[model samples]
Target: MRTNLDFSPLFRSSIGFDRMLNALEAASRTEMVDNWPSYDIVKTTEDDYRIAMDVAGFSPDELTITQEQNMLLVSGQKTNGEEVHYLHRGIASRSFQRRFELADHVKIVGAGLANGLLTVDLKREIPEEMKPREIEIKTNIALPKAESRQIEAEKAA
Candidate 1:
């Protein structure tokens, strides 16, 4: 199933938003999305986010997290310890890698694994210069002393 989204109007009206629109378009075209180690994205506050994934068999040492240019990569690989033969294995022990495309200014705060769940925290920090500020409009102007005296003399006469 294909859902068409037209961005021609956005391109004509907006500036410096082409990257965002392109990312959206690429995300929409992505196929065979990974479902392994199910995860949830939660908004803890206005500029904070939390991502929790089910990593039952993976340990802290086996997992690796890295961030580069607005992209977050998480991978897990089980080390070779001892060989074990199981009659019926229910839990998956295979290595897997997950990629998450984060928005601009978003940074990973921390990550932790607890109770078969791996949670990653993120925070968005916009620079002070980029933040909106009130521009003071100059509405008050002083008249020259000569012009003020002339007007007063005319009024008196």
Candidate 2:
């Protein structure tokens, strides 16, 4: 089943969020994608995150991780190896490509492959200018130079 979404109302109040909404809509449409390798996403800290994927029988060199803007791409290609006569094969060694949409300020920190699991770390580093800041507000206790001079003259009179 597929459903179309209208974001015209949201566009009136939001700017520069079209890409993100498009990513979400695309993901929703492809909900029936093949679940080749399982994965997990965990928040390690306030600004840190980790993505772990199962890549059994796949080596680190055979996997490729690429980041473009707010999109993260992870793909694996298995190379032809020595043939082994086996009556049954259970483990899957097929090529796959996964796309992950990331939020603003989120970036890939690092990645590692261990025990058939591929872990990718991410961190959200908000720049100093973008971080929340407290603004200092001044009261109306002080007046302009002209007003101060006029008040002084009135006092002298």
Candidate 3:
């Protein structure tokens, strides 16, 4: 069962969050949920992440990994060989494409395929200007005092 949420009220009150809200709305509206080739996302450290996907029947040459500006695309194309009769068809060998949305400054460091698992490593590299900085505070600075002079009124001018 799926429920649709109305974001009209939030759209009227929020500012500068249209992109985020639109992404949420689009995700919610997706009718077909494809769970093929299960994957896992793990955070190894504060700035490092890893994604492991199960691609049992795919080889390195049959798979393609692409990294766009803020997106990561993984696709697999199975090549058909000579037909062979099988008593039981238990394994899946179909073409599939999966997309992952990446955060700002996140980059793909490396990728490897071993033991039927495709592992992708990512690291977040924040720019120097965007990183948080400490500000120095000065204390006890003295200001110069104004000169005061005594003025005597002219006596009986």
Model 1 lDDT tens row, 80-104: 9789989999998889999999998
Best by TM-score: 3
How many residue pairs clash per model? 0, 0, 0
Error of 2 at 62 (Å): 0.7
Clash pairs, model 3 backbone: none
If the candidates were sorted by their TM-score against the true structure, best first, what order would they fall in?
Answer: 3, 2, 1
After superposition on all C-alphas, the RMSD of every candidate to the true structure, in Å, is 5.6, 5.5, 4.6
Stronger candidate by TM-score (1 vs 3):
3
By lDDT, the better pick of 2 and 3 is 3
Ranking of all predicted structures according to lDDT, beginning with the best and ending with the worst = 3, 1, 2
lDDT of each residue in 50-153, candidate 2, tens digit only: 99999999998899999999899999999989999979999999899988889989999999999999999999999999989999998887765663343434
Two-way TM-score contest, 1 vs 2, winner: 2
- Which candidate number has the best lDDT? 3
Tens digits of lDDT, candidate 3, 43-123:
999999999999998999999999998899999999888899989988888899999988889999999999999999999
Q: Which stretches of candidate 1 lie over 4 Å from their true place?
A: 3-15, 136-157
Worst 10 residues of 2 by lDDT: 148-157
Q: How close is candidate 1 to the true structure, as a TM-score?
A: 0.77
Candidate 1: lDDT of 1? 75
